[model samples]
Target: MLRRIDEALINRANQSLLNELEADYAALGDKLARQNIDIEAITRSAADFQIAVPSWGTGTGGTRFARFPGTGEPRNIFEKLEDCAVINELSGCTDSVSPHFPWDKVDDFSELKQTADEYGIKWVSVNSNTFQDQPGQEHSYKYGSLSNTSKEARELAIQHNLDCIGYGQQLGAKSLTVWVGDGSNHPGQQHFQRAFERYLASMEQIYKGLPDDWEMHIEHKMFEPAFYSTIIQDWGSNILAAMQLGPKCKSLVDLGHHAPNTNIEMIVSRLIQFKKLGGFHFNDSKYGDDDLDSGSLHPYQQFLIFNELVDAEYRKEQDFNPAYMLDQSHNVTDPAESLINSAIEVQRSFVKALLVNREALYGYQEDNDALMASLELKNAFNLDVSPILAMARYRKGAAINPLAVYRSSGYRSKMAELRPRDPNATGSGIV
Candidate 1:
């Protein structure tokens, strides 16, 4: 594979931190051994853990109010792949990228695949966008798209999803994610039943187009662009639609898509119970879909979600595999830096989750010792896993300190000269 950053720079960066990392890692191993936890096992899990980065997130993201462009942002899909490569090279956790339609559209699939291959990256889920209309388009999704009252608009939306699947097939993507901004501002403006029926009909057509091995992921959001009601507003509606579609259809959870203080971990447990959970779009939020970096605002919440996931893993839950991906917006910081740090934050949560004494926690639950059970979780969360994460990256031939190495390489400034700035560039809003 072609490398965007020099190996020598990474080696130098690691050399500076090597002794310190080794000391910390040995200390951590001894500490974990006291609790009967093998640090090597957790390190292996951390090394193997992977998450897909959103293609659009490589650029500067903005809110509906305004966008402040970042210097040297990717100009197109190829450039985006270049940036994604840098991320994977340093963090070693993001080897795949989830692409959005139209924004990543290209004429030659073969060449696009070749370019991605050179970067040592592959396509994850291909996201379909029917929320907004394209220039010179016949349909206006202002009212709705898949769930539109107009047959023409709905058909157009369906065809777009079908096209996305075709593109995904060529790009070696095995799933298609559909999230539409189709709802009403007024309570009675939309006939709820009929709109959902239309949505089902349209989705059925798209489902039929899925390859034998590919799955269909339906992403649900409560409100945005539509205030009063959204078609697939909650997990209940998401599961219903997934069931209606079939086994290949599953629900995707965006962490920021739910109402404030919702029991997202319980929702994850329930989705795993029924095998309806497909994957997640990982991000942090305080108010609404802020799309802040992963674990930035709610590190504990992120850890708890991973706790449930690791519990499911320990039990060997039936058909419990869920895709992991980061979906966030970088408005103020450099996009590449934010992605690398976010990937590490997520990996930290996974390592910490693995540290949880599940057997003891279960015993506490059986004895109705609520305090002990909560304390069990708290103990694991309190343990620092930074050494494990750094060592994992180091062993994988990646940077021990990804952010530091990236800055030393001067990648952003180099790209700034390579690709001129675009004054009118925009990104997927807030997410």
Candidate 2:
């Protein structure tokens, strides 16, 4: 194993903040007591929360046109896991990684598993990259992949996904996430029903290939690379495909993949009701799939999503387990620092959502008291839960102020020397 952030450095950094942290935590506890909330309970929930980091996100991301590479971006999957380990060390909430294949593919799957084991990291969903084609490719995905008009292209896509499942099994992943950029660019360019039919047929084969213990997650995107329409365009189509495939197949929601002003929480509720909600690709977006940091643009929206999630937990809803992973594309900031901040922001949402008085909210809803119902949600969203989040990290042997400790450790600067940048950024390059 490589040298991690020094324990002494973290201890020193945390010691400076411990006094203030305790004071704030006590004040918050006192405030919550009147509302019948337990600060310790909220802190424990936060400490127990674990969001997986996307391996691709460990590198600097760019817009559709340009990429501004950072000094020490991970050159391969192993290097990416190294950076992911550092993020978990500081944040303490990201114990697993969601890896994308063809991008993260290697000859030795056993070595990858051993490397992750040494770092105490687990694998979440293994993502398939049918959106872009790889080198020496026999088939081009320019028109489409799984839903391509040509049978050969569709078969190639299906095989790639099956191959991803094979790779994931060795890495200890229980799920496969499929997001295809297959759609029509022009209105008359393609027939909608026929295209969807083709997609379902291709997916059926991939579904059949899944191990009995594994699941297949279908991710939908509104638009990008193809503007007119996408096969799995929204939740409606996502669930439809899931239903057609079988029980183990379900929809994976990406926060940035929806149309503007769409009521995502309602969609999440709908998915939960029918027992088809699979997982999430957590990120914030101002426009379309901007891949901004989590909870950056709209913390309230993030909290609202969590509110529904916590409600499901409160109700003891069966089959409610949804894997959470950060899916931002960091362009300017250090990827590790951005990941640390994103994890805390997400944890902040979860912590605050737990503060909601479920009984009060339910009563207000039952009575149809609009104002009180609104206030019930607003009240929980408005509170600052920083102390609880910090306390959780402190108790987990993580940094009290994760970002501060990360900067103090100088991990990035050191990595710049160890993993020098490639002249040509190969994987997911400039697109």
Candidate 3:
């Protein structure tokens, strides 16, 4: 059994860290010299980036076809917190956890809050699980939950979301996320208008249940359980639903929930423009909802999205802050290591976005110099900002090389011993 990794590997990664920081700082100084921008101010701004980890993601994640469970995977919420603590301790970027209802449901809400606090983990957003039916569920969401034609089924779905909101309030969570797996596989299986009307009607009740300070996030997936079509299928539908639900409702962008080659960052820009961007479920996807690690497949795309986000922040756009959370499953790697690496990857994107020569880009845009504007973004993306990231982690008492530290510590093997592997296991029902 592997014990946790030692401190040497964690400390050794600093050589590259120092080198990267030096090069980045020099480059940033040059860019600032050209435009009179403040490099120090940008570095300070980079220190403020944070994203929440999903509790469900702490466990071993598998595809619909197959799942290979990890040895020390967390079996419950408490164990999940332990994994999250490791992630935060090593990465210094993930300070919160987004919990899924029923999957993370427990009796002692107060105790859960205290436990999380002890681990320096805050509950960011409470996700409602209406995609599948739970034990003793009176209504079946077989066809759909909110969009189901059956009045009883729709009513049950509405109640479940409301209940989730109530749980969020108890847990000191400020937002509720709703992702329903409701759509049709075969043609003529459901009516479009009536189904959407039912969904809207059900959502209205859930909206009313939200506390004054709470925001409701509607997550839309193009297709999944229903291969043909899905309600809340695109950003347009998501925004329309949010508009109907009023100011408190906003659309959440899950990176894996889109068609291949979709301009997701453009969609993000549009949502920010409308002031209806609630949050994001960050991940990478090759085919459809691959739920792979963030910045693994399309790092440039991630950087581009952050480019738009940093643009909004620079302008001080109203209601510009968007919640961010990891929504990837660990199928092959240690769940803890994957999460820490993913969080750091996300931070890398944010850091790269911060490096974008905003003034130059703005000037190019004003002069209508499309090539220069494109060049400006590419310049920032091309620069490696690893040192700045390492410095931030160092300042926060995290490891310079999080994955190396985790591996040297041998945390996973220790966990395997503590929590014996399950011979016959059940799936997490994510795909």
Say which candidate scores most in lDDT: 1
lDDT of 2 by residue, 1-431 (tens): 44388878888989999999999999999999999898888888999999999999998998766778898789999999999999998998999999999999999999999999998899989999988879999989999998899999999999999999999999999999999998988989999999999999999999999999999999999988789988988999999999999999989999999988999999999999999999998999998898899999999999999999999999999998998999999988999999999998998899888988999999999999999998998999999988999899999888998888888888889989999887765545456
Model 3, 259-323: lDDT tens digits are 99999999999999999999999999999888999999999999999988989988999987799
- Model 2 scores a TM of 0.98
Clashing pairs in 3: 3-409, 3-410, 4-408, 4-409, 4-410, 4-411, 5-408, 5-409, 5-410, 6-408
From the highest TM-score down, the ranking of the candidates is 1, 2, 3
- List ranges where model 1 is wrong by over 4 Å: 423-431
Candidate 1 lDDT over residue span 1-431, tens digit each: 89999999999999999999999999999999998989899899999999999999998888887777787889899999999999999999999999999889999989999999988999999999999899999988999999999999999999999999999999999999999999999989999999999999999999999999999999999899899999999999999999999999999999999999999999999999999999999999989888999999999999999999999999999988899999998989999999999999999999899999889999999999999999999999999999999999999989999999999899999999999976555544542
Alpha carbon lDDT of residue 38, candidate 3? Answer: 66
TM-score of each: 0.98, 0.98, 0.93
TM-score quality measure for candidate 3 = 0.93
Q: Lowest lDDT 10-mer window, candidate 2?
A: 422-431
Once superposed on the true structure, which residue ranges of model 3 sit more than 4 Å away at CA? 1-39, 427-431
Indicate whether candidate 2 or candidate 3 has the larger TM-score.
Answer: 2
lDDT against the true structure, each candidate: 0.93, 0.92, 0.85
